[model samples]
Target: MRPPDFEARMRAGECFHDVRMLPAAWAVLRLDGHGFTRFTGRRYEKPFDAAFHDQMIAAAGRLLERFQGLYAYTESDEISILLPRGWDLFDRELEKAASLSASLAGSVFSIACGEPVQFDSRVWLGARDEDVVDYFRWRQADATRCALNGWSYWTLRKAGRNAAEATAALHGKPVGFKHDLLRAHGIYFNDLPLWQRRGTGLYWERFAKEGFDPIRGVAVSTIRRRLKVDRELPMKREYGLLVGRLMDGAGSGDSRRTA
Candidate 1:
């Protein structure tokens, strides 16, 4: 019962949409973010300990293996997945994996060190593997530095910088007087590990990308509060919010239904 004009349309080079749709089985999938210990005082010799990194790798691998045939990538702290179209409940699987990762992280070095960790997961529709790769690369190359600059600024200010008095000069509101303080300490954001610097920068850049102007340097107390907001809760909620939004969008008539 093919439409009478279907064959003719195909021969004439007609397409259903401007974008070429992939065959039915393929889908865009991903998980991003990582669990980490708060390094508030006395830098941990190495920004991220080797043992924690290994455990995260292992946890991600377990999830990847369990989801065989799904195109996968683990770049930086995020995990990307390209799933089969028929697998409708990928969120459930993601939740399971995230929960396991947190548990695994707890048993690892962060716990004994008195540092709590947090992570987040997200998936994109109509996204390509390269998109995911580029996103993470941006994180590594640029975003990390912002995070460091922000944190360093805050750290220095907390150590006693005239933060309140210097508010307008920094950006707008007072953050921490870290920039000036760090300068006194002879520590600069560029001196940190390249990856770590990216983490610092990217975290602070979130507001900018969303069209909001950044406050001076990052607010140490504010950034700490944000970190706590993200970390204090069990990690799965970030993923859950993404999943919920996707489901809501899909059900809404406003969204295109090509996939």
Candidate 2:
């Protein structure tokens, strides 16, 4: 409908903003909910909600299946997805990867919750395996801290304090103080559910299934794989080791598929 040079002019103007991740580097896409504080306040329970947790796991599964991600970890309203070093989706374009990841996750969660929601995403580049391990470890630590704070804040609010008063009660308080505050209310932070403290992990696991082949008239076996959702995640070095094993297993599967 326009002149012949119209398309060329538009392309030239937008081309400079195209940026890509470095080749051969691992990519971790972290998606965080936008305005979820107000959104979830009326629709879900505080501290932890089982229905919301299930929705998050379902959304994580969708991301893993759609993006070929190696793993996905979710805590609260944020999800972090791991991609292999060799992945080249969307030619590693930064804008494309970030936008699509956010949109996909947001759509899945919104549909499951029966409400409109939005998520924003950012990519983390890991130059080596250790970097990837550290990235997850850091996020897990954040989850623990947030879990503690959330329980404490809500406990004070339920007792009689308003939102601002409850927040001020925790400001500048050390971790131990927060724990003691909950202890005073008869809640042991360590005794809470594992998923509440450590976040949830989703990945693929393989198994062998035996079947009878009618055409061949014999018993046969084949490998099968499916998505696994882990709510009771470990801590510290143990979690790093678990993630390392998952990465190794994914690499082995890739090799077999190519061969």
Candidate 3:
């Protein structure tokens, strides 16, 4: 009945429950909004909302700053953070990383939106740089697919189709069908903002800052790092290259449209 004996007995119950991220591999922490569909209804514009987008970006930025992530990507209701191979946050405890990150992101976004929100987080492991590149490419593809379906569905809804009707109309439709549906409504799918299709990316960049050297009575420039939010990300092979460069520590100064 001693306190130390009770503590040891309780610890034994968690022996196989806790998991850790592999130290030699890259860890991508992906946080997804829970129950956002019901939450966003009537509160945000259909398909997309600029204010909500900004809130997501704010949450992603906080994650990057707190964890020193190599890169961050957000689309729809989810954000994915890329942690370097050597990252040792929480001693690479998977549960700690996921729980704390989800809580932090939910808190940051809730404060920004003036309403409580929740995100569920998970850790993805990549064994190599190419694996990392492929993972992002996959996510970008999912973004574009979701964008297309969203526009198509919203177009129908605005044109008098009910929720069930809109869902049924595009349920078994092909990609071409969705594209044509949007085009018929005077919305060109390809011409839509790149961020809608490819998702937004955030990474650190170094830039020169000018300041007065008061002690020496002279103006001096120094290098500083800032988190760059990219809205217009590249596609396909180019997108892969961007991820590769980021993993290799050459992401700064890459050309892209920003918000």
Native-referenced Cα lDDT, model 3:
0.90
**Per-prediction RMSD in angstroms?**
21.7, 2.8, 4.2
lDDT tens digits by residue: candidate 2, 1-259: 4776898787888873578998999899999999988888888889789888888888888887788889999999999999878888899899888899999999999899888899999999989899989999999999999999999999999999999999999999999999999999999999999999999999888766677778867776766777888999999999999889877765225211210
**Candidate 3 off by > 4 Å:** 16-18, 212-219, 251-259
TM-score of each: 0.37, 0.93, 0.93
Expressed as tens digits, the lDDT of each residue in 152-250 for candidate 1 is: 545546666665633433554332454555556676644644434432110001111122225643322211101001111111344334333332322
Cα TM-score of candidate 2: 0.93
How far out, in Å, is residue 79 in model 1?
Answer: 7.1
In TM-score terms, candidate 3 sits at: 0.93
Tens-digit lDDT string for candidate 3 (1-259): 9999999999998874468887789999999999999998859998998888889999999998898899999999999999978899788988789999999999999999999999999999988788999999999999999999999999999999999999999999999999998889999999998988889999998877777777777777766678999999999999998898899875433332211
